[model samples]
Target: MSARYWALIIFIGSIWGTSFLFNAVLIRELGPITVAAGRVTIAALVSWLLFFALRKPLPRDPMLYLKLGLLGVFSYAVPFTLFPISQAHIPSGLAAIINALLPVVTVLVSHYWPGGEKIKRHKAAGVVAGFTGAALLASPSLAAGNEHGELWAIAVCFAAVMLYAITLNVARSFKAIEPTTIATIAISGAALTSVPVALWVEGVPHIERIETWAAWIAIGVFCTALAFQLMYRLLPRVGTTNFASNTFVTPVVAVLLGVSLLGESIRPIHLLGMGVVFLGLLLIDGRILKIWRKPVSGTEVVSPR
Candidate 1:
């Protein structure tokens, strides 16, 4: 890959990573349903407008609609709901640790997909280690106050990350469909689902305040619309392996914004948890030093062209 490509990935990771800060701010004044609803609703509206301007046809196949709807529900609606819920109790860093399992979960999910990446011993080890870090990170939040209740929220974060992993694989099916189509279908469907829930639960998102409005805008534009566009552009280049590496970058970004912008604090355990999680992901991906030292064998050696 070119340096430009690598830089793009890092940039995208950073933008998406900062979403935790945006989400935390928004959730302060809005209910989970309202925040989640606004993101997909606004993203859907914007994407569909773009598609309309381009005269793009919506996917005709029923299966595409089904995938889009499912994608919208799990990837957008549920996870959007989860982040704010978890942030209500736990810090974003802890939520990030639980999310760090994304790569490991993606690897595990790929195994069941037809002709997907074959699971190997190294990947298996990575998955186990990564999951361990996730468990450790969740511990503090659970232990602090009504541990079980806090744990339930953290569990929602876990389920959201798992769903994200599934979406990473499932999104390949959108190759024939326009990227906008997939995003449009998913976001629109999610928006519709969220509307009723938001109305009933949150009642229109605290419209009178400035910061509340800012939070809503950030969720809708920055977190939802812009982030998906960036993801679409980069995913094909990075492929899944390195693409999953974005999770490693996201938490650091999330932590910085959480602490600096949201006035959230960090402790030694959180830093230690970050280290342990990074170590686990490194282990999961395998030791670079060992792989570098080994010489290419069999028919794979480079030949003079």
Candidate 2:
């Protein structure tokens, strides 16, 4: 990748990483449903405007719309709501650390898909390590004498990641669709779905704080809209494997932002848990381990998919 590609990846990571903090801020003033709805509505509007500005036509296939709607529900609406609700109870950093399990979960879920890569010994070990780390991370919240229901919050985060994994599988089926079109339609569907839910669950939103509204706007424009646009542009240049590696960078940025900007503190055990989870992700990716195990002979080596 060129320096510009690297810069884009880092920029995307930073934007997405800061999203947790934005969600945390917005959830304090608005209900989770409202926060999710507002963000997606703004994002959808921006996406559609861009779609038209670029002279792109909407997909004519009804089946594609159906798939995109499902993608919207699973990928955007549900997880977006869950993250804020979860962060209401847990620190944004902890929420971000828990999100590191996404690739691990994806690996496990993909094993069951037809023509998908089966879990090898290393991946199985990775799954075990990853889940163990999640357990370790959640243990403090589950311990006796703890008043808050942090376990439930962690479970909600896990559920969100599971939905994300399902979305990835759904996305694979839409390989013919342009990335921007998929994003625009899916986000529009999310807006359509979320608005009703938000209205029913939270009623009309009333924002008195400029900072809160600013945070909400930032999450919608920067995190959701701009990040997706950059991702679509960068993916073709960087390739899927390299683009997916943004997962490794996002959590680190989220953790830093949460601690420094949000004044969040992570326990020592949680840090250890994060380390173990990252190790599992590295194992799942298989490149680093493969490189270390390569022979001294100057021969080409192929890493596992």
The window of 10 residues in a row where model 2 has the poorest summed lDDT is: 292-301
For 1-305, candidate 2 gives per-residue lDDT tens digits of 78888888888877888999899889878999999999999999999899999989878899888879878978999999999999988899889888889888988898998767689988888898899889889889878434787888999999998998878876887777888898999998899999998999899999999989999899999999889888877877897656767777777888888889889888888899989898888787778777887774567878999
Taking all chains together, each candidate's TM-score versus the true structure is: 0.87, 0.93
Query: How far is 54's C-alpha from truth in model 2 (Å)?
Result: 1.2
Residue ranges of candidate 1 with Cα displaced over 4 Å = 113-115, 141-148, 286-291, 295-305
Determine which window of 10 residues in candidate 1 has minimal summed lDDT.
Answer: 289-298
Alpha-carbon lDDT, every model: 0.76, 0.87
Score candidate 1 by lDDT: 0.76
Clashing pairs in 1: 126-284
Cα error, candidate 2, residue 11 (Å) = 1.7
Give the C-alpha miss distance for residue 28 in model 1, angstroms. 1.3
